[model samples]
Target: MSWAIIQQSLPMFGKGFELTLWLSFVGIIGSIVVGLICSLVQYFRVPVFRQIASVYVEISRNTPLLIQLFFLYYAFPVLGIKFGAQLCGIIGLIFLGGSYMAEGFTGGFNGVSKSQVESGKAIGLSRWQLARYVVFPQGFSLSVPAMAANVIFLIKETSIFTVIAIPELTNTALDLIGMYYRSNEYLFVLVIAYAIILVPLSIILTLLEKRVRYGTFGN
Candidate 1:
């Protein structure tokens, strides 16, 4: 409602948005890598690694990002394992997002037809070769929708970074509200900032999903 307040807050919000983008980008990438590793471990039923991956997924998925962030930012320092707030934020996002991504990827792997796997075996494809050539491609394609959802989820989860005093968008908004007492204006700006990033991102992911679904991405 107060354009002046909103205008004055733009620089702060811009900086916060920049940090949010960085955190989200790093988190998404890390989560994808972690998820891929875990899912592959499970898919292959690796000896000890499969059990470890399953336990890790269960723990990560069961816990809240806030709790994980607190442990990383607050609890770990008590044990002499300290990380900066930004690092903690990134780790928290990856920790939580990775589990969801693993599940998504596992689902994608499951969606791979059994006959196709058999066919790959019949062709004398090694396990690794089959995974690289047949399984990974189809699984990733099947995973597009879930991956998009998880990316969006991780981006939104960055809001929780405020608890760790990360200068992300939500923190910026809270600071503005505390300083000016214009909760509505700051909240509106916060919403708009997220919309600016997420709206286009959502549209792009949707388009990518459609392309993957019908445009021969995995084939």
Candidate 2:
């Protein structure tokens, strides 16, 4: 195996990695928000939103992330929709992550006690206060484990962005492979790159789960 040389095209890789991280961060945030909105709508049994959320969750969750990426990348153009590659990646990640996040939120919403919900109402909490102080806190806390898991899942899923040409971490590695003409070395770099990302993410989430497990959020 040829020895690995650090490609001086470092800025390119940096840009790609930054794009990956930013998109993942934005996607996670967006999906969580979408999930919260959907979960709340369904929890209240809102007539229209609930039906929409139900069908959306089922469809998005049922589809593979890669196929969804392709749908946005390839299929959307057939309908006269034009999205940038980055935008397509972001949207794909959002929908994919939203499905998992919504399921997590739904589980949390279901697990929350009705009495607690009523107790909030008994205190004369307004709709905003009820959701902000009462429902969201408990529901989110109860879902912390799920949230952590979702974070990890979505991070890994970001690799799919390469399929849509988002130039993420994997793309950088492939770039190095062709440029360096050292397949094994670049493969090692690929493993190292992902390992660097995955190890830290796992450790962080595990610690988060520990903190949440011992904390009193369930009432």
Candidate 3:
């Protein structure tokens, strides 16, 4: 907490926090795309794909992320795929986050009453039409809050990337500690730095949850 240490760590923490923000943003987008696709497969019960998505979600959720990162970084190279630590870290985190998001969306799909879907079918709508025009839009509201929470969780989870030398916030804080041997001072800034990025996301997600509910149920 010394003034000198605070001044010294600012640049390092800022740079690292920037990288963490960018990494989380990119990973969350990738996870959302993957999650939605997988959810669709599960919804329609596509041939063999439901099985595949199930396996993926179960395995990803069951395994620790650190292990996934190691597999991506160490095992993939053995299979002739070259990747930097940052790339590998992103891939692992996306795979992990996508599974959780898919589960959340599946819950959303369930939240839409079967009667709504039946009504869509009664209107001469095909399954695809019902899903696109009716079901997905309505059902997705049921899970948007969970989905947003998952995204926020992904932001905090980026702390693990420090283990991979990803130059994220935690990594830079540790580096500062190493350089100045002021672990206490650097750690405090690290906590605040992450909070600065994440606290607003939490607030946004809460507001979004209310909005989704209002749109789906209130109106």
By TM-score, the better pick of 1 and 3 is 1
lDDT of each residue in 11-108, candidate 1, tens digit only: 99999999999999999999999998999899999999999999999999998999999999989999999999999999999999899999999999
- Across residues 1-219, which tens digit of lDDT does each residue of candidate 2 receive? 543264554566577667777888999999999988888888778998899999999999999999998999899999999899989988988998887899998887667688888998999998778778877777777788898889878978888787777788877777777776766766675666667777998898888777766766532
Clash totals, every prediction? 0, 0, 0
**Root-mean-square deviation of each candidate, in angstroms?**
1.3, 2.6, 1.3
Stretches > 4 Å off in candidate 2:
1-4, 7-11, 114-134
Give the Cα lDDT of each candidate: 0.94, 0.81, 0.88
Residue 214 of model 1 has an lDDT of 87
Top candidate by lDDT = 1
Q: Residue 149: error of model 3 in Å?
A: 1.0
Whole-model alpha-carbon lDDT for candidate 1: 0.94
- Candidate 3 per-residue lDDT over residues 81-180, each given as its tens digit: 9899989888988999999999999999988888888999999999899989887888788888889889988998899888888999999988877877
lDDT of 3: 0.88
